[model samples]
Target: MTLASLDRISPRKGRLSHTTVFWMVFAVIMALLVIAPFVLPVFWLKFLTEILIWGLLAMSSDLLLGYTGLISFGHSVFFGLGMYGAAGALLHSHPANLWLAILCGLAGAGGAALFVAYFSTRLRDVYFAITTLIFAQIFYVIIFTWTSVTGGENGLIFSRPHFAIPFLVDFKFDRYTMHWFVLALVAGSYVLLRRITRSPFGMVLQSIRENEARTRAIGYPVDRYKIVAVMLSGLFAGLAGVLYAVQNEFAAPDFVFFITSGDTIIFNVMGGIGTLVGPIVGAGFFQLLRELLSRLFGDQFPYLIPVGMVFIVMIIFLPQGLMGWARRWLNQ
Candidate 1:
């Protein structure tokens, strides 16, 4: 073969190898996680489950910040609404139907997303971020002050719903079962989001991220796209919240606070924005760091100081994030 043809074929082969390696590694990690519940102690199992839930939340934020170029500080609103919606259904319903509770959570999150997107999408840059922050604070205040409805800072606890598939399968979620359930949901979400980020619609989102004016001039409805993206992001965030409420057996107002949204953004940044899997990795890493630090230092030590130092170092040395660095190394 000619040198030119050989060179082209070599690059293609290299790309294929990289892709294959990635999938192989991914499969192995998933297999390990599947078996983890059986081997790990109860405390570690619960901790890992918490990480997966938070990872899902981080992935939701990545949809907006990484894909849509929208910095949202009101994701906590959707999450909080979802939690409350599930809580209300479980507490008030006669049977505490699981599917119905999930639907309620989705409805609450979807509605809030539409409401926030209507006004927030019109603004750009930091103004949009500020608007979302304000909206989150507003919702937090409402949830906290509405004594009779929201439990007035005390939050509401509910019994766990049974996992059922009509007449086919029905069971309560023990620690192991709960971990498996959460893992399944999270894996499904990652697959869906990965598909989304690789689709034609995802291309347009990246274009919008790069240059909104050009995308609009090319005949795309930028505003409509942004609103849809926000809603999609919210849907997943709400799902994460529902899972969290189910795991914890309670819904609290603290989660609705803007700080929660900020932490999600940090996860995106730390993991490498625009990569769907990055945020999940970031969540796992951050949580592990916190757990380790807390154990070593005890309650008296301000762990955030060390965590902040590590974060600063990461920003300075690995600005593209952990996943980004891995990608670069693989390519090299």
Candidate 2:
């Protein structure tokens, strides 16, 4: 618009753009990840694994909430489906291993999403959320009531992590190796989500989120995209559930419970929803805080008080969350 502003923005012919700096920062983060396993404690490492799992779940929710403008409270149903699917697979006539059971769980979540999204996608906002919530509770009740199959309240605790192969004790109870496994999955999910966010599909979802009517008028099949996104989200959430079941070698009826889903939503909001990376940060923050509080305060009255204060402070001061604050700080 003006000569002074133009001169400020224009490159002096050879400098790297701001995009280059962003990558540089990301590269440094990757380097830190490479060294994390050896540095982190065993307890914290396991906690991080749970955080990564839920972080991915929250990321999937953000895909619907942030990118597609579809907020369905029933995501917990898909999450539960995956959990039970994995557990049930192990109980089948021909029992499945952890990996196969995980796959089965993801399939179960995806299948449920397919069945629900078919009808729910036609609605919007509260209607869609309510439909999902009802279906999720239905699934929860089914899991709760189906005691013989689900092992009832006692739960099913299978033997230790037995590899299909003969003698690989390294991956069994060695916290170090187990942590590496989790780290690899977490890193892989992060890369996949980044690509999803940058892909054409991601852009289309964002467009739909911004204005579905205009996107549909411009010839995009908006409802179909939403359905696909929901299924995909379930796939990831189920994968997370499989990891949860395997890591614990136990499956509770509560896997598909509404409270479990609510926890994820809280984590998503706490971490800065829609940013993709925010959920991981938020999950880690909360888990770490919870652990520390349990140790320091011992589940007393003021236990939640500190955690609540932290969230309140974040909401008021850093509404966008840690990633937002970091971006601003780095830019400045």
Q: What tens-digit string does per-residue lDDT give for candidate 1 at 26-89?
A: 7998999999998999999999999899999999989889888989998899889889989998
Error of 2 at 253 (Å): 2.3
Judge candidate 2 at residue 129 and give its lDDT: 83
Query: Considering every candidate listed, which one attains the maximal lDDT?
Result: 1
Clashing pairs in 2: none
For candidate 1, report its TM-score.
0.94
User: Candidate 1 at 295: error in angstroms?
Assistant: 0.4
**Per-residue lDDT value at 290 in model 2:** 79
> Candidate 1 deviates by what RMSD?
4.2
Worst 10 residues of 1 by lDDT: 1-10
Q: Mind giving the per-residue lDDT tens digits that candidate 2 earns over 76-169?
A: 8877777778877766624346566867888898999998899899998889888888888888787777777877666666643543543653
Q: Estimate each model's TM-score.
A: 0.94, 0.86
lDDT of each: 0.88, 0.74
Candidate 2 stretches greater than 4 Å from native:
1-24, 93-96, 163-173, 300-306
